[model samples]
Target: MHIKTRLTILNFLEFFSWGAWLLSAGAYMSTTLGFTGVQIGSVYATLGIASIFMPPVIGIIADRWIPAEKLFGISHLLLAGLFVVLTSMTSFNSFYMVTFLVALVYMPTLALSNSISYYNLEKEGLDSVVTFPPIRVWGTVGFIIAAWLVDVLGLKVSHEQFYLAAAASVLLGGYSFSLPLIPIVKNTSRTLFQRFGLDAFVLFKNKNLAIFLVFSVLLGAALQITNIWGVPFLNDFSISYKDSFVVKHAVFLMSLSQVSEVLFILAIPFFLKRFGIKIVVLISMFAWVFRFGFFGVGSPEGMGLLFLITSMIIYGMAFDFYVISGSLYVDKMSDAKVRSSAQGLFMMMVNGFGAVLGAYISGFVVDYYTANNGIKDWASIWFICAVYALIIGVLFALVFRYKHTGEENLVIKK
Candidate 1:
């Protein structure tokens, strides 16, 4: 089989496994397990906490010793057992501990998957910037399919989602061994600081990378808010605008974001090739402002529907350009020895620190607007988020002044 085809399959199952539970698990805990809001937050916080540190630690191991594909397989194999345990846990304490362990095993695999993909693609003489976005789009498709399946099978609030994920995890675990090996890049003469992730920290010494990473954190906060709130905000219209199709089919409406994602993913190679990393990423930041801007103003009626649809459409550009391109930038910029760790650092900043901040600030925004009677002013909340994105865009444009040479993605410096 072609290497890209094989890797595409791998990417598909990787995200499909995640989509099975990540989105609907809260609904399950809330409705079926009878968990309160705080309890659910505590349980879900496990993922953010695990993302904070695990990726870099595992990346260090992959960089120094075991091949990345081997580590990827081992992580998923462990996840299979963890998910099984998670399926049976009934108490909040036990569930929290077990699910926390689940996150620990699962989170690192995200970085490993990229490391594996980039290494294998280079070995096969393919350019990741040219080839990867297309393959990566399949992962999103797999996620959409998984989410749809969970709903179709009536397992949204059931343990079956975990069960299905476990099955796929085990399959991917075994298949990972068949993938091309990603050799360990180690220096035997390194000092202890250089050996233990201080090396990855050196990436911050580069001014352009430093600025990019900072903005990545701020932009990362914007990334999850739409996914978290879009449906519920649309649901608010279900009563007042019962005749609106979007109100009645909010899940399907939200799915438009993922659909639009595929199109933008295809377009990324063109934009990145022509514009270089700086312009491409700046476009992403601008897209985010518009993404939230549309939401803040749009209603459920005729023109408002266009606003909502436009918001979902731009989601493709907001996420793919910011994240996928950022990963490509990291891959191109870092030393091969520290590549995995560098990718891990990117995951840590965006998914870890950025997400944690977004969660708290978004929660505060929601709570502050929540009337004593429990009503929320979502318009004001989204407007605040839009303003935040606008400020980030303006600051990014003014502050991050990188002129992307056509050679920015010049072959990885050996």
Candidate 2:
């Protein structure tokens, strides 16, 4: 097979593994297993907790001892077994523990897959910047397809999602071993701190970078709210709008967010050049307000349906602008030597600390809004999320300082 074809398949299965269970898991636990909001949130929080330290630790191992491809394969194989185990878990404690273990083994492969792709692309003498996006987009396609399959097969609330994910994990894990080898590079000069990317912590001395990172954590808290609740929120409508297409196809409707994500990514360079990163990021912050507000008011009927769709569309801007643009900003401002570690730090703040905060707090809000009948007040839940985003945006505008020159440009370097 051609190198691009091979790498595309790798990227496809990589996200397919995640999409199989991620968005739908909350609904599964809520509707099928009768778990509480906090319980569901705790389950999802495992991903954030594992993300906090596992990736960097795995990266160190991949760097100094094992090849990236081998490590990636090993991780996925373990994930496959864990997914099988996850299907049998019913109690909250058992489920949370297994899910956390699954996350610890699975989260690192995200970075490892990227490393494998970049290594192979460079080996083939391809410019990754130009070539990789097209390949990576297939990951999104895989995610969408997996979600659709789960929805159409009526497996969204079934343990079958884990089974499907396990099948994909096994396929990807085995295929990984056949990919081009990624030689481990042993750098003797690097100290333990540098090896673990702790050197990037020095960037905190800059007030602006420090503030940006802190807010990154705050905004990151918003990132998983939809993933953990969007399906459940939509699924709730089955009580009132049982025959409605949105309820019947909630995961499929939510998949539009990923579609919007692809389209919005194309617009980032233009927005970055015109408004610069600060304004662009500010636009993202407010977009989150609208994103959640729309969800707060939307329903399965008439104008409410439009609101729901609009929320999904806005998701693209809300996500890409903050994450992609913020990464670019970090890359541009940091010294080249610490640039990689700086990027790691940004992810740590957002996906690690931010995710953990969002998961638990949002779960609490969900539980708070639930009445004695166990019915959730989704509008209140979403309004609270919108208000949180609005406060973050306003505060960010007032406190975080960055002056954008008219000469701003978007240049993604390898």
Per-model clash counts, in order, read 0, 0
TM-score of candidate 1 relative to the true fold: 0.91
Model 2 TM-score, 2 decimals: 0.89
Best by lDDT: 2
The reply for model 2, stretches above 4 Å from the true place, is 1-6, 115-132, 180-183, 190-192, 195-197, 328-343, 403-414
Tens-place lDDT per residue, model 2, 305-353, is: 9999999999989988887667657655554444434555677777778
What is the C-alpha lDDT profile of model 1 across 1-414, one tens digit per residue? 989998999999998888777766765775578664456656665666787898888889899888889899988989988888888887888888998999889988888888888888888999888999999999888877877777667676688789888988999999999998777865674689876755887788788888988887888788867655665567667557878876555555666777788899899888987888888888998899889889988888888889989998998999899889999888888877787898998888777667666756776776688678656688898889989998998898888878766665533443
Q: TM-scores of all models?
A: 0.91, 0.89
Model 1 scores a C-alpha lDDT of 0.81
Residue 210, model 2: lDDT of: 88
- Using TM-score as the measure, the top candidate is 1
